[model samples]
Target: MSDATLTRIAEALERLRPAPAQTPDWAAAEAFVWHADPDRLEPVAQVNRVDLPLLLGIDRARDTLLENTLQFARGLPANNALLWGARGMGKSSLVKAVHAEVLAQNLPAKLVEVQREDLPSIGRLLSLLRVAPVRVLLFCDDLSFSHDDQHYKSLKAVLDGGIEGRPENVIFYATSNRRHLMPRDMIENERSSAINPSEAVEEKVSLSDRFGLWLGFHPCSQDEYLAMIQGYCAAYGVKIDADTLRAEAIEWQATRGARSGRVAWQYFTDLAGRRGVTL
Candidate 1:
């Protein structure tokens, strides 16, 4: 073909292809949201999270994650953490809170949340974080893999595989209701379908094993739940008489048919509203 024809084809192909993702300006914010469609890091000037002390229950979890994050921020060796357990027990909240506390202590660290759906773009996100001027905590909330989802492979690669492994300056934290990062049925399906049942189950659930820290959150007791409510009330200055507060909190838990840090927060919001207090 003539040079002109070849040049025209090249131009058309370039237009058809998607634009390369923009490198993030990590210096702009302490928290960011990674969007994969356009592949950009959306800066968060303020993250939505309660103070670490406000998270009353899960004291063990709070302390453990905080120490791990603090070490990572201080340029000390720290392991990637997987916060997995009971729903609404503050798995995700603890991650954000820990990040905030670490920053408040003046440790150089940033939090960049990548939604569970964006696992496929983990490599791209890591590339942006790799060159960040300060240490980064790459967070993913409510993360789990299903039977047919191969995105887990990408996560596996980013965690520990291929030539460019996880960046030393970056650590990953994820929260899930599942300990294995896979559904029970999915694990069972793999066990039944594969020739080697044992290997299949291990292969399917092993992504979680990559994490050095496994902080499991169990269902909170009634007392723990009430403690969360009390903590919120004290922090936000929600004033309700002790008797009324206890009665209302009990009713709230009864109505919800569950007790957890999330349920406690919801009850506190309701109580504060009734008392004409803003949270």
Candidate 2:
């Protein structure tokens, strides 16, 4: 071919090839939110999370996650974690808090919040992180799987069971309302539909097994709830008499119909607002 023809072909090939994926400057922020459409990381300048000490009631869950994140930050061995349990018990909050705690310890770690719907793009995200310099926490909050949902399969393989495998520098942490990452009814449906009932249910439930650390958060007791309220009050210096605070907290839960760390924080926020205190 003539030199001009060869040059034209090379230009045509360049146009046909896809553009290289662009990752954000990881140093821009301590945390980011991953979006799939643009396949980019949105820097989270401010992460809305309570401090580690402010996380009350779920002490065991808090401590375990903090320890695991610390280990990961220190470049030690750590497992993928599943924080599962009751609603409004601070599962997501704990993850953010733990990341901050780890950073305070002088270990370099960055957090990336990935939505449940972004699981399909998780492989691409992993590919980017695999070559990045810093250690990252890939967090998915309020994660759960449904009967028709196949994104969990992608997550399962990336966590441990796939050819590409999980990136060494990335740790996956997810919080779910369901312990098994699926509803009982969905599992039952699989049982009824599949030829091998046991295997069918096992296949879905087994996703939880990929997580080495399964931290469970339960509903806080009245005292525990009150303790959470007090912790927030103390942390924010929302001063009030012990008797009045107890009475109001009880009334708040009674009207709300449930008790949890989330309710406690909500109650505290209202009380602080009325008292003209801002945290």
Candidate 3:
């Protein structure tokens, strides 16, 4: 090719390359994920979250979380929430679903999930979001600490607002099976060997106290469990006889030796497959 033609081709290729997009207005994002290494916010264009109405069996807790989230979405004062309780009881699901619900109502806040291990980087996250155009619902699922873990201190500081305090536009929502977000044995061990036993307990116990709202999830009752099963059935259009469905759901729970929304959902999935129905 001629030199002039080669130069022209190069120029054309350069022009075809896309320019970097502007940093999105965070307020416009409904969901996001925290990237801690380089300290950045990555927007989630489409969040895979269920509608709030689909969650069942934990009526009181659900109502409480929804009310708090709604208030936050509406720019009203709302407390940080700690959802602690039985496994697979929809703690994390409720958080995500509630975020989606509130956003659907055209609220100004967005949801962002950070990893438990990334708690120490929260200060950086807060700094980034502090001035963003949107309010943020920061979530950490199954958050807990081991005996040797010191990151809890950072979390405590952040939740307490530290020197800068938590951002006015941001709120925290965490889910864990442990109320203290630490193992009972760890707390016991600390109490057993620490020079000041009460102080040791205080150090660990105080972390949870930072959250103004403590929503506990208990194992669902048998009737509630059945209601959950029915709810899923109705939502998914899985037709089954009531008596048979109840018998099978009861047997399923018995065989598993536990009952919760998760168990009911799992059983329904199995039942749907066995009955040759797609879920």
Best by TM-score: 1
Give lDDT tens digits, candidate 1, residues 16-63.
775667877878888989898778889998899888888876889889
In candidate 2, how many Å is residue 251 off?
A: 0.7
Pairing residues by index, what is the TM-score of model 3? 0.87
Clashing pairs in 2: none
Tell me the tens digit of each residue's lDDT in model 2 across 102-181: 88888879999888888888878888888989999989999998879998888875588377678889999999999999
What is candidate 3's lDDT per residue for 12-68, written digit by digit as tens? Answer: 998876443334566546787876655666888888765677788777888998899
The 10-residue segment of model 2 with minimum total lDDT is 15-24
Superposition error at 34 for model 1 (Å): 0.8
Q: What is residue 8's positional error in candidate 3, in angstroms? A: 39
lDDT score, residue 57, model 1?
68
Q: Rate the local accuracy (lDDT) of all candidates.
A: 0.86, 0.88, 0.85
Q: What lDDT does candidate 1 reach at residue 165? A: 76
Better of 1 and 2 by lDDT: 2
lDDT at position 132, candidate 1: 71
Ranking of all predicted structures according to lDDT, beginning with the best and ending with the worst: 2, 1, 3
